[model samples]
Target chain A: MAFTKGAGPHQRGLTIGVDIGGTKVAAGVVTPAGRVLARVRTETPHKSKSPKVVEDTIAGVVEELRRDYTVGAVGVGAAGFVDDQRATVLFAPHLAWRNEPLRDALKARLDLPVVVENDANAAAWAEMCAGAGRNADDVIVVNLGTGIGGAVVIGGVLRRGRHGLGGEFGHMTIVPDGHRCECGNRGCWEQYASGNALTREARELTQAESPVARGLAQAVGGDPALITGPLVTELAQKGDRACAELLEDAGTWLGIGLANLAAAFDPELFIIGGGVSEAGDLLLEPARKAFRRTLTGRGYRPEAEIVAAALGNEAGLIGAADLARDALPRWRQGRRQRRLSRSRESRRAF
Target chain B: MAFTKGAGPHQRGLTIGVDIGGTKVAAGVVTPAGRVLARVRTETPHKSKSPKVVEDTIAGVVEELRRDYTVGAVGVGAAGFVDDQRATVLFAPHLAWRNEPLRDALKARLDLPVVVENDANAAAWAEMCAGAGRNADDVIVVNLGTGIGGAVVIGGVLRRGRHGLGGEFGHMTIVPDGHRCECGNRGCWEQYASGNALTREARELTQAESPVARGLAQAVGGDPALITGPLVTELAQKGDRACAELLEDAGTWLGIGLANLAAAFDPELFIIGGGVSEAGDLLLEPARKAFRRTLTGRGYRPEAEIVAAALGNEAGLIGAADLARDALPRWRQGRRQRRLSRSRESRRAF
Candidate 1:
């Protein structure tokens, strides 16, 4: 870990950001400039069916990072619905968390000021502050992973909506009774436009033993189950016609969904992030074409620019740390006020 | 005109609100409580092919209203894209308004403070302040008319988006390649769920002379051309199963779109307004059911309440008047400052 020394007065101390995903817990000591000084990673105890186990895992990573660098606070980005107060995880689909007070639990164990946020929101904030959305005040960050995750930023503020469930763009129905989603709905946008969609279509083609999918079949050794989103993307990047066509199909779906978002949000820009975005223009070109064709009042209105996110997978942790840093002054002031009130009460009792 | 005598200090004076539509121009003198004190209606000069004709019509209505009531300012709610500054009509599909400086034109002609806004945005602001969305902090108003129009209010402020074109919900593509829309898009939500959709379907059924169309055909005197959205709604209200089925289908589409909005906005309430909304439970019951079924994180998240709008057609004008009133103080101060600056410049010249 190479630490950038003397990060100016405003930059102050470092903060640790933990990204708690369904499969792994990744933590990093992030500077004010969104640079990571040190990092630690561990597998999520999702199989344990204990929220405490996940909390313990997050604490362990923070402790590991803190051993080397003195951090001011910890920010945890969980892949779940976080409360507006950013104190509890309301529910996580792949984790054993049901109304879990993760922030309080982590703060108690780590003995530091902590903030909790939805992973998508964290990533969006990171992008807005340091990446592709740096100059845009109104942006929508779309994360094209297994399923789609989204965060909306308007007027430079992250909009969590009334219930902190805003920006669940993937679940918006694109086709009526089209494809059944894991969320028990039919025709979700993600079912057609996400990484899962990309891989699912490729796998189905290979499974059918289609001549068009021969290259993909041979790459995965004729095992359809071995086909993955990244494998298809890699093949496409290597100039595989079949893989490129599949990506084009997904890109088309992606554009249609983005046009729908434009109607609803009319954002200035859309930052496309997540793992699948690594395909770059191979994915964005088709999406952009579809968006232009499908956008409402295309010529009459200023169309929002759709671009790839600059930050990689580390955006979530970086944003979480930045958010925690932004909240630090208030958190410290609150703690000081509480201590003063407690002392006054004790004096009165004496 | 019945004036509530001795209104409180805060409710001093009256303001005029003008609603410009494709077919008609409606203006009203509104009290601070969102009440219409007086009204005047005239056909829109859409055939003139001149933006000045529309401005003249707006000015004529304001002058007529001013004769009966002493209005301090005027607000015009145009059915087009209003700029973020509320000064220009960027575009109106129905009217000859392309980059029309409507506010300055109206201000010059009427010699009163003027504010121009999107009609749907004006209606949404009205609902948020004094109608169905009253007491709600976050609201989305869906106007189900010939086509759907929408406005979003978040944290009690109307969000007009980066380019003041945020709520074009009618144009969002619902079906991949279903119905062709007049807006040059295929499968727009309005093509499936709006007033035009209802009438078009009813006309199709009647034109095909199907057994299910007998009742509707008889009602429209065996002419499919006479079929209208309101006619079908009325028949459905009188217990016409075929007409009821049509409304139910439209309602289902409405609910699905609402569910999609919930995923993106998570507003506290969705106030349904416009012509088709008069169908009441005939349209809303099925829509609510579809919304509940299609909403993402259905069991975990708080669902926004979908309800009929409180104010009727007068909502646009009422909201416009209220918005004008809200901007009155600032407008007055600006004029005063300008006058002061002008006098200072003259003194310096002397």
Candidate 2:
């Protein structure tokens, strides 16, 4: 197996990073320093129940990229739970994958080493390494996409839980018996603090054809489900008073949840990313206010900075490729060392 | 500095550990193995505003125990925020201590090395070393006292946060705009799941003169304010249905908060300690049930064990002394090494 400490001037080999979303597969040939040197995009075979079609699409993307660049390894960040070994996709709600060994399959087919990771974890790592969370030992990345996805880093190490299921921030039950969530729970933080929440609130108001939501209702032809988070964000950014107000309300909920996170993790920095965070201060201003107001022992402790992710939508692709290039070898080495030590102890016992 | 890796047969020196609570000061001479050789207790000079009064009381207890054992060092676990250096008490709500240099003052007067720590951190360390969390690399100790207190260890290192205020678990907001908390927030976890919360519920029931609280009201002579957490625990243990129901409520809240924690830290074990934990499974069973139900991605992740602390109330004193004997020197050495490396780097630049 190829081993490199990190990105060095002489060892700047390229790696392919693939982000498999619900609708599309976005692939990029990322430089060792996390720069996307080249890119490719293809629609996901979403209708296929078989995992083969999706794997084939990923392999095709890698082969297409391999034609242009001498890639070392491939990192695929899936919107689902990745196992601790970074070798399997345990589950993906939108994709036709469950307990899928995507890494080994891709490795065998593409003839390149592969690593898999949860998309949010990849994004957070990108921010920590080459974006807003640079130089901070502890960081939390709140990816405010369709749902409020999260990733945590403590003491410069990603804190994947005992079963590699840590950073499920969106599903944390913030309010008991409150709003119903898709995850069979009530009052989950995401239910009240995400893109879907913002759209849901705005869409609800449009049903009344109220003066505040008149423009939104017209834009979506009076269909509440047709309203997207980005449309609301665009409307808010264009100085639409009602959309801004809606964003403010969602931001406040975001801030309250962030305060709860502050009380628990005490991170040095919080990087806000994803489609919703693109609204910038429209979403963050109220969040900042709520975070300060709700933070426990606010006056006594130093407050962590809440900033937008610098890498934008490219975070997952960049972070995944970098992890494949840098972290994968070290992780494999550590696992081998543990296994070797255990065998040595067992031999001594005999 | 006398440096020791950890407790071992070769380093069998005794240390004096003092636990300064709101009502009293408890002191103990503890061996390297965490055995309390001699114990002392004294009423706190609560009325005295002078720091000297408390310092003198602590010294008196140490002197009394010194007559019985040959001690090497002293450790004091203050029921408040200890600075990152573990040398000063920043601000204790219950005690008259604000930026008090307790370690230096004790070291000067006692002529022995002294280490100070947050009482909850001390207890958690004790549990990690000698009790329920023994052999666990990652652990979370939820100390349920008047309010909730917390300590976390991850990857074999105590997570003290960037500002030495990491384990403030009591303040995590579970209910948005619910009950008003003393921390100027509404619906803090401690407001719902603590000894104070238990007593407050019982008192409110007594105020209504309800049939359910009739036995508890009679236990305190009908004076609701006179009802303490221990009194309620005793009543519940003796088969008071109302008191047991109250405990169940608190346990449920505790479990919800634990689930939230699992989303964040995901430790392998959670050692429940402090005075209220003495109720054992009466409090824990409900907590465990709630923990499983509320846990995010429950079936997908490994459940952390929720066990009672074995060292009991003596945890604070014993842990503090052991930390003084073992962790202090290592911490000091680390600081010294960092300082040396920084200076060396600067010198090399010239």
Candidate 3:
């Protein structure tokens, strides 16, 4: 419970943030201003069937960060559905976690308060606090990674939904029966708008040996398998027409989905983040145009601004750490209640 | 400023609820419990270019109701967007209300406090207060009428969005490059799952002179132009397989959109209201089945319950009356402030 405090809200002391992604486990000692003072990284035990292996990895990183920073609380952002209580990982598609008590496990290891959050929610919090959505109260953060992930913040509070399963924007069907999603649905927004979509289209072009894809094929040494979302973005940035067109296609899908979001939420702003957003204007310009063309009540309504995320990859860890700090008092109170109940039970046993 | 007050929240005094639709103007003297004690209806001046005609019609209904009951406030539920201030009708698609000062006009005509709200929002408030969504803190009410309209209530408060333009759910795209919508967008959800969609399909079937549509064609005396949404519902309820199948198709599309809504809002319950909901389980059973199959994270997440709306068509007026009563205090305060400012200006002139 030993935590430092600064003059302003954004200048509060340190907390360790652990971001558990499908491929990597990244941790950082983040300040209240969303700055990472210290960091550590390791591969995730993504293939492990036991949840304990993933827990151990997270504990290792926290322990390493805690050695130097006197952190108050730890926040672990995971790539899955975190329960409403922010304690358990209900189910993770990319990891071996099903109803895993992630917060308690990490708290027991670190001897400090801990909170579990959906990675996208964590990223959105970062954007709301210190990144693209800084001044906006009602904002939506869409993470365009391997698959799309998203979060909604309304009236300056994150809406986690009745079951902490809200903001699964990527899974919304854009085209019925079009492209099959990993979630078993067809024509999901992510299937057409995420980094996966960009990489898939680039590979398809190179595989077809289309004359238009010569630049992309040469960049990948004529091997379609070598093509990735980042590689496509790089070529697009270097003025490769085929690669640029692929990004535009994904961006158009992105805009269409955003328009749908506009109809549903009517948010003030949309912050686009993750790997695909690195393409900058190449991805966002088409998205904005499509959003304008597709939005309902287009002429009558004030359109929400679509902007690239400011915090980039560090948003997950930064937001996680900040959220843990914010929840420290509540976590402490819960701990005290649990301890009191335990003592009462011991007395009864006597 | 005269108003009635009752003992309980649900037993508040009388208010007049006016529902302004594209074709009709329905008004009722409603109780706090959402019961309509007295009612009135007239065809809307939908073709008139003058906003004053609609206001005058609403005034006529209020004056008629005043003869029997001493109502406290008046609430108008219009078919399009109401501003966040609850004072203006920003832009209504079905009426001649472009940035119309609806509340002021109604207040002036009736000599009472008035509040204007989106008809869908008003219906949702009614459902949340005394109908299907009673006791649910977070609920989404989707009105499947000529086109879909929706409202979101979270933590028992209606979320009107930053611009009061939220919950335009029908405009959300369900198909890419699919049916063109009157809103100048293609593939809107309403194009697939609303009463208009149902009527259009039924008409198309009969117009094609297909054997399957023989029952429907005969019902309308071989004239497809005479076919309407209610007629189709009546046919389906009477055990017509073709009509039932059409409803099932719309139901499936309804469920897909609901799944998308679940992904975004994660409400505990969904109350399906409006004209199309009159078909009951014939429409809802298929929708529920499709919702279960198409929901994101499927078995891993808690699915929202989809049920037919209570209070039927009267929901819009009932909800409006209740909301007006709730907002009475604030309206009075605003009036007092304006009066004080006016008097002060007169004093300065003297």
Candidate 4:
């Protein structure tokens, strides 16, 4: 009802989408059809960061992107809880935001309507509309990078539950007291299934007093600290049995986590993104097998299809842009039209 | 849009929703606004050697309900895998159905259209339309009884994914190598948090080796087998320290599972339904604490409001009736109107 129906496609200026991550901040201008028109990026500072500085950094990126396109509004996809109004970052584990008034602050600086969303939600939206999940209606997008991140899209809309913490798939305890997670919990899903976990396991396995350590030892030299997730991927891809086993271990744990996700949210497709996903089937083949085996009532259930993301690193950029486009006044008009249709269906049911 | 939206409230023609459980088969008629009409229940046949008899028995219940109302379509919510078309029971552990064409078989006997869905999805739908979630536009309904079940609805529509095998929340693993689950998986969410686990722990605690179990041992007459989920509920309510601890333990596990769900679906509301919910805060208070404690980046996110289901056992009836109300020929009037509006939205969005 608040939307204007049939507002033409280019009725207003474009908005900017800013993706704030632990390592970097990316910004982009997106079109209504979900295409990113322009983009810019800047690395995040390591120590003694101020809120004003972060805002300025993000604003600077937006200015660069905005120069090419007349920006109307802005959307920020932060790696933390976004308030219900999509205005504030209540807290961010890896960032400087602590009960920060992110939207208003950014709006004050940029003079635009800034809608903030969870980063996982933004990535999932990108995959659904223009990435790996182009045609799938129900999908769970898992980002397997430093720590595991997740977002669920059910019937074409992001599911950002009551508290905005709906996609914290990494924290689901997979062990009662397995590993000490950065979140101060034991046996959280991320502690075992994430890139950090994988790298840690690789280092441990290579240093083990067993025959499996030999090949890994030769690959990474004598330095256990030298092992990394990419080296393990290289080892596995090079057909190293030891590295393959390590990946299988990670994959098994990954599958175990995914099965839990399957049981919790039965989406049709699972889009695996992030750095670890680049290992492709080496990680996924075992994950697929383990997912099938771990799923509840295995023989009695229809399994969800697991796939890799197509958008790669661009997902965040594209996702942010798409979110920005949707915030534009013209898109609001179109959304109103969709809402009208939903209400029409509602009326008929009544 | 096969449903006829404009049917009268008291119309004789109705739809049947059948909930297939390990213990019983319950069938009822539902109204569009999520009201259950007449209901009938029959004991689930023992794990007999014959599969046809079970279906025959279910058909008998449907037939009896049909005799009372002008039942138009039939919906079966089986506790196992429903195939892609929602036509056949691909597999069921409790029931003997392997590639069973449930829809056609039932349709053949009743001469009606039949749609089969996952029991979890159906139950979730029941809550969404008639139970605790009647007002939510987006909801994640989790059933925490003997086993956990899940259903996700966005914008008031239940999401069934690619096939109907969506919303299997119990199998989502909260712990890695935590406990062996009946699903042949290690450490499924249900392994630690369900009524089964609750009662199991209660029995183990009250065994001969433990002095702390004196309170429960005195009540159950040393018969460990008598420790039912409800008995535990009663003991927990009466301030039995051992039993209270047991419920708290289950609640913590439930919280862990729910946190995972929150991370995945981000539902506006979480409706906790099922038999185990009868214990009220004895279970929920701990769950809330644990959810807050374990949620990733706690205090940095929006959280789902966990509430007990209001509709109770009659949910399936109401949800099924509401679903079928649209499937009938007469409801086609509503479909026609909705299509017009939807097309208009598509036109506008483009």
TM-score of each: 0.92, 0.89, 0.91, 0.84
Task: Give the fraction of native contacts in model 1.
Answer: 0.73
Tens digit of lDDT per residue, candidate 1, span A34-106? 7788889889886557898888788889989887787788999998898877889888988988899998888
Cα distance off (Å), candidate 1, residue B149: 0.5
Off by over 4 Å in 1: A8-13, A330-350, B7-13, B330-350
* Residue-by-residue lDDT tens digits, candidate 3, A296-317: 9998888999999999888999
Estimate, for each residue in B183-221, the C-alpha lDDT of model 1 and write its tens digit. 789999999889999999999999999999889999988
Pairing residues by index, what is the TM-score of model 1?
A: 0.92
> By how many angstroms RMSD does model 3 differ from the true structure?
9.1
How would you order the candidates by TM-score, starting with the best?
1, 3, 2, 4
The numbered model that scores best in DockQ is 4
Worst 10 residues of 1 chain A by lDDT: A332-341
Error of 4 at A34 (Å): 5.8
Model 4 Cα displacement at A209 (Å)?
7.9
| Cα lDDT over the full model 1 | 0.85
The candidates' DockQ values read 0.38, 0.30, 0.36, 0.40
Error of 3 at A345 (Å): 44
Residue-level error in angstroms, candidate 2, position A211 = 2.4
What does the lDDT come to for candidate 2?
0.80
For candidate 4, give the lDDT of residue B186.
70
Tens-digit per-residue lDDT, B1-350, candidate 4: 12235544345555778888888889876544454566789998776546778778878888887776765678888777776577788878787778888778777887878777777777777776556776665677878778887777655666565556667777776666667887776777777878999988988888754988888888889999888999998987998888889989999888877776666666667788888888899999999998888766665555678898887766655565555555567743122213223323432221
Residue-by-residue lDDT tens digits, candidate 4, A1-350: 01234323243444567888888888777654455666678897553688778888988998787666666678888887776667788877777778889888888888877778878778877787777887676688998888888887655656566555677778777777788998778887777778899898888876774677787788767788998888888888888888888778877788877877776566678999988888898889989998998887676566889999887776776676566655566645222213223423433221
